[model samples]
Target: MLSGAAAQDSAASATGATPVAGTAASALIGVSVDPSAVPDSTAGAESSGSARRELVSATGSATQPGGDAATATAAVVDGSGASAASAGAAVGARHSASTVGGDSVIPPDSHDTVVILLPEMPAMDAPGALEAAAEFFANPTWLPDLAGVRDCWLVTVGGEQVTSGDPVPHQFHGAVTAGFRCLGMESLGVSFRRVDLAAGQADASRAAALVRAVHVKNEPELALRDGAVYAKRLEIDAVQRGPARDADLAHVVIVGGTGTLGVEFCAHYARSGAGRITLLSRSGETAEVTRRLRPIRALGDTPIIVESCDVTDADAVVELAERQEIPATVLVHAGVNYVRAELAEVTPEKFREMAGSKIYGTEHMLHTWPRTPDCRIVLCSSAAATFGGRGQILYATVNRMLDVLARRLRAAGVDAVAVQWGLWDLEGPLHAVGTGPVQAAGVTPMRAADALAVGFTDHADHSGAENRLVAAADWSDVQALMVAIGQGPLLDDVVAAAAESAVVQPDSPGSGHRDGNSPRIAGTPADGHRGTADSAAYPSGPDRVRATVAQGGTKAMTQFRAAAGQPGAAGGNSANLAERVRRQLGRVMGADADALDPSVPLVALGLDSLQALDFRKRVQVELDRDLPVAAILGGASLDDVVRLMAGSQA
Candidate 1:
């Protein structure tokens, strides 16, 4: 953090205000200045107009790298032009104070350096606070009024200064061009006092008032909670500006088109109103996957090309590329593995089982996918890539490889990303994904359907930079709502929001929002506001933002552990029982056994969002004890749902 006087100096300079020119700033620890030099607290500065009397108000605290709280002092110019000392703001961020203080004065001929005082600090241990504070210094802004900075300092005291603000983060800052990384730190919290705001005798209050606009008056200044979960500064800021409302509905190709995650993505992009779509798979499953995509297929002539191409075969991939059409975008998820071994115990075969998908397949996709000027490449990574686990070397290594992969793509001038997927609920097909069983853990897993929706949005908006998308369970609901939008004026607000952000929309080939069953105009206008109905407007990547599909806060896609009352999925005759249950459900929804797609919106029919709310009631009437909502939602298919129907099946 820069000194208060230094802050005022730099900020004023950024605004093009001429510096008082001739006086130097100073820093002194804990010494009360002479009464003549300090500004009187009773006086106040008025607003732009009116009978106002408030130059500025102060609150918040300053923190060192890791300690809880530390005190810092700034010398503000007094009313008589001498500098005075003052306290900082609330919420733990330090700032200058000149509102009640006088202008700062200095002996033009004397060599007096403003001695800003930082008293002793207390210990603090907020998990990401150091990273946040580091980001703040790297780029300090207050609300809508922060200025660009050139250089600044983060000083720690020695001896008495050392005893008080002990163990300050002593990263270098005196000369210039020094690089100090703030990946993780040990200290935080500091208290600051104005040492001296001496710009040719500018009054302390006047100097403090210079930075009044930097403080937050309306919105609450949020800080990352001290934990593993808090988001990075860039991510937190990006999330607040909101998600992009407009998207390209033009053409795109998703290579791993049949896997649960891949197909789900195809459906979302199709639903998001893309023009032409080419869905590919290793086998001949694309046709069936496309057939199940009714909402997207309804978009008309949107060709869902199902082709067989082995991703691991370089020649086959090259041949596939030769026949492939260049899409505005390409998403490759051809690499997926079934490895589930402890790192120490994992064998070459087990490693190959996992490697065959991510590495070889992705390499093939990179070589084969037809490139376009507007095309973007998405490399799906995992949360485990950033944070490793005991039995997840295969999974974690594959995820991390994306970072290097994205960088290489960037160096090649192609839009690329390594999206780290959080554990999704339906990752049952994936070997490394299972996180024990869900019932024992209260983790909220993401559905493959939801994960795909978020992934597609990432695909459409990726700017080619190295990105990591962290999918939280909340993102599932939010992105699901985004993908559910039917076109026309209803999407006008979305487009407008996108335009405001200077982002572009894809050229969609289909007419949107033809929901004939609703009473609302085919595509009704939203309350037509931005900000609300928003969760997807943020950017798509961050090293810390781990792509949160269904896993993250919930459990990994580990194998399902059967409850005491139910038999294990593999050992029991659950398949036959599940099929019978599915048939019953199909009858309830007025559809054939095969009509339902695992990921489509149930709201399309008579079911409302509240449909899930009724599961507990169903459990009581049909199966006895109340079952969790996830129990019903996580069921592989509606046909064989176990939680509510388990008792009946038994």
Candidate 2:
């Protein structure tokens, strides 16, 4: 079925007129099926009904006649049988059909097969263009119909985006294909293909050949260039280290230098003998910033400058760039801002805020910097841009732009690389959103110093690829999460690496299991205790209190009261409830129960949305009381939560 734009383009092209400005000329140029092929008189009706059902099942909505733009095409089958025109008319679509021979018919085996022609995306810089493109490609109206087909081929143009070094406006297509590939693997169990045709190669014969190739091959990624089909594979090139790799560390400009990562970069460069360092951030120098810089300053005679500059403000960035006396030998764009939100909850404004620094900030920095060979531009992108993460659609989209920007810079002979970093073992931006979900997905946080070392060394040695992913991951956990999230093909290399180095290590000290394959919650103790070690090992003070909460029951509560040491409440009273809440909160926040003051608000104790949910669930399960998420995260103290839970129970 042709989209409204596609139909109009096809009509215009057929009449020797110019196609619409923003639409590609597309046509359904296959032979029509014989109406008498179906012996059953009601076969056409059944097929039409099946098509509608399939659409509904795939997208949760069925296309109705004369509906919106998406439903411009519909399935229409006559009483005799389903033909190309009748099929289109049945589903509210327009098509031109031609019959080859009188006996020509759609084979029975090919009934469930489908080929989806994705429309070419226009420039996304225009207002509402990104949203429109995202809606069209990422959540395409045609995607739903693929759910009904046993075999499907998703074809698009512009193989240059993936194959060539030049950057193209194909970010939307990249995201769309990645998402569908995962969807196909996890749920549909259907054959899927993303055929990227070269210029002037968009035709029925070329598409048919690609579809035929897909049937015989099991490759997930295939691109057509120079009239030949090629399979795409992602591989890691071995680093070849050379001398003077650290020469660029003499002078450094670290953007977002007040944040956790910024401080780490500042300290690392200082220790590496950087003669001068300039730190730019939205938050100007504060006492805490001074305190953090003190250690770096003590390392050597390196002059450290901290200035307030929002990188997203183009004027601010330009002003800073112009005022620099000595050009920075190294430029590290570590600035980032984002909130953990599902795609449905990500408004355009929220996306803009999240993407502002990374997109416009990177552009502004790159434009201002002199393109000298000595200068190295290091963009701190995230693994979400590489393999995607849950609740990070906007984050991933913006980071992917960084990856593309790096490539574009390299293509223009600028020394630039985007490092797709994984979770870091630091109290940085991710901490605000809570690290529970990422940890649960099997990503072990890497030490900040070690990750930086590896990223820089790898980039210096292996300068071929403009974008690289540096992460330490448990492949089994990653694979499981990907499967759960309907992700496919993107992690094939990781899967292979996991297979190559699979080992069975002995269980850790507190874990109850001997087998190495069992899934463990991030901060839970071996015996299912939230925040304490085994009671027998540390049989005193807060440990005993924590153990009692872990081993909860009426008898355990009695034991907890006896072991409280200073608590006045007895037998399921507010004091007992407060202790349990404290231990559980400590567990969820990955903090020490004794260190968490009861009077302090949970938010001040670093409680986040994910932690709050986890705390709420634990309360529901252990305390047998329902606690609202708001009551936990709405600036409530331990005593407040205890009172709230006690009241709910009462």
Candidate whose TM-score is highest: 2
Worst 10 residues of 2 by lDDT: 7-16
| lDDT by residue for model 1 (366-471), tens | 6667756656677666644432333454455444444445534554577665566655656545434555322112113444433443444433244532343443
lDDT of 2 by residue, 383-465 (tens): 77545554676676666666656645655667776777777778877878787777654455655643554455323323332
- lDDT value for candidate 1? 0.33
Error of 1 at 514 (Å): 21
Instruction: Give TM-scores for every candidate, taking all chains together and pairing residue i with residue i.
Output: 0.38, 0.56
Best by lDDT: 2
In candidate 1, which residue ranges exceed 4 Å CA deviation?
1-250, 286-291, 325-328, 431-433, 437-442, 447-466, 473-650
Query: Candidates' lDDT values, in order?
Result: 0.33, 0.48
